[model samples]
Target: MSENRAFFRETVEQILADTLDQSRIEASERRMLPAALYKALEENGVTRMLVPEGKGGIGADIGDSFAILRAMGAAAAPGPIVETMLGNKLLAEAGLEPADGLIALAFADDGAAVLHAVPWGGGVDHVLAVTPSGISLSASASWEMEAALDAADEPRDTLRGSLGAIVALDTSATLRTAAILRAGQMLGAIEWTLARSIDYAGERKQFGREISKFQVIQQMLAELAAQLLASAGIAEAAADAGRETLIAAARSRLGDAADAAIGIGHQVHGAMGFSKEYALNHRTRRLMAWRDDFGSVQFWRRRLAGGFVTCSREEFWPAIADAGNRRAA
Candidate 1:
């Protein structure tokens, strides 16, 4: 890893350790991390990791930002680091002031769901709403907050306001950026789930032996570990790749990772895993929710397949290679 990435990893890990305080709360409580953790991040400049130094941000590279986000996911911190950083980057790139609060790109259900301008409430201060046409932003509109469906089927309130300004820019780049960040979060979740499951298995008893000693248990753990590692590798590679390629890789790897981690984690924990009292449920629930957040596994798989089918093999290889080169440069 580069020095910047290593530093980012260390910084985020420390922040998560201090803020998460494993003994004080369970996983369910973690969902509130974004609201609770926001102050610390703002004070520590964590939220500005991707913003330019001149713009009061840490000006970290995309790879560095991904590392920090992954660590946050591992700790199950509920902050909107990915949304803030990426949104800020997009706004700054667009020559606009970075609006405050959590800014996320919303995709219309219409199959195209590209970038279309839509009015959003001012409560969020910033938002990226995508339609089939292009990206749109509303910084000054009054927001009306109402509950909306999140990836996990939980009711997440969305701020609906007027369109202060609409910019019809191709959002393929922005969509790709969001996908890479989301993939990093998934990687972190998989890592944390696998480690926690292993720890639980070693301590929990079954059939007069530690559950970890059982061949069946060991096999499950092995599979979970493999999935975790594989997903982490793919996510890291995707982060290193530029936008489009990152989206493609992340769409596939993140979904697989989330499903595998949740499946094996619940299996290892069994009945206890389902209980809200158990900390495992927190991670598993989020994993389930996150899998469908930006897009579901099936959604991305179809997207990747469709893209591949339309492009020649020669063209496809070059696209992937170009993404890698951009990251290196």
Candidate 2:
């Protein structure tokens, strides 16, 4: 890793370690994020890492930002940090001021249809509509609550928007950006699940011995480790390449890893994991939410298939070659 990247990762780890209060995460599971927790993130520069130095930020790169996102996911802490950072960049790109207070993003596929899946809609002060077409800058004050969960208890709500008001942002590139970040989040989640499961297996006695000594438990961990490593590699590769197909592929793999990690993690923890008190739920629940946040494995799989279907068999090989060459450059 680059020295800067190592430094960035260390800083993010420190900030999360110090500020990620378990009570705060548990509270966010039932209600909106606590204001004090948000303030801690902002004060620690977690919220402004991506903002340019000229714009009162530390001007961190996307790699550094990914490190933070992964750390947050691993901790299963609550906030709109990713959404806020992405929104700020989008607004700056279109020559507008950033939104104040908590920010969230909602997806819009149709230019004229109102999007209903505005994340954290109930508590967010402002939300921007993200579509394959463009991004909206107009702030919506009134949000009708339609609470939904993608398997996690974190707040998710619905809202509508006028697409015409949005600027014509690069939708393809934007999707890649979101996919990469989501992949990073998944990586963190899987890492936590695998590591936690191993620790639990070692501590939990079964058949008059530590479960970690059993072949079954060891096998599960090996599989989990393989999945985690694969997901991590895919996330890093997607970031390094910055290609839509690569990002979609990474998302697909990472989503699969999230599923396996969560399942194996809970299984290892047994009844305790299913209960409301265990810390295992916090991280696994976030993985559940993240798997479908940007695009699930199925969603990205279709996207990846479409890319191949559009290209003739004769052209497919050359396209792959060209993409590899571009990455090598």
Best by lDDT: 2
Candidate 2 regions exceeding 4 Å error are 109-113, 131-133, 160-164, 310-329
> For each candidate, C-alpha RMSD in Å?
4.7, 3.0
**Most accurate candidate by TM-score:** 2
Measured against the true structure, the TM-scores of the candidates, in listed sequence, are 0.81, 0.89
lDDT of 2 by residue, 112-212 (tens): 45666566776777777777777875555654566765466777766653555667777656656766776677788788888889889989998799999
Q: 216-315, model 1: which lDDT tens digit per residue?
A: 9999999888877877776777777654545665667778778888889999999988886676765667677666656567776666555455558778
In order, how many clashes per candidate? 10, 0
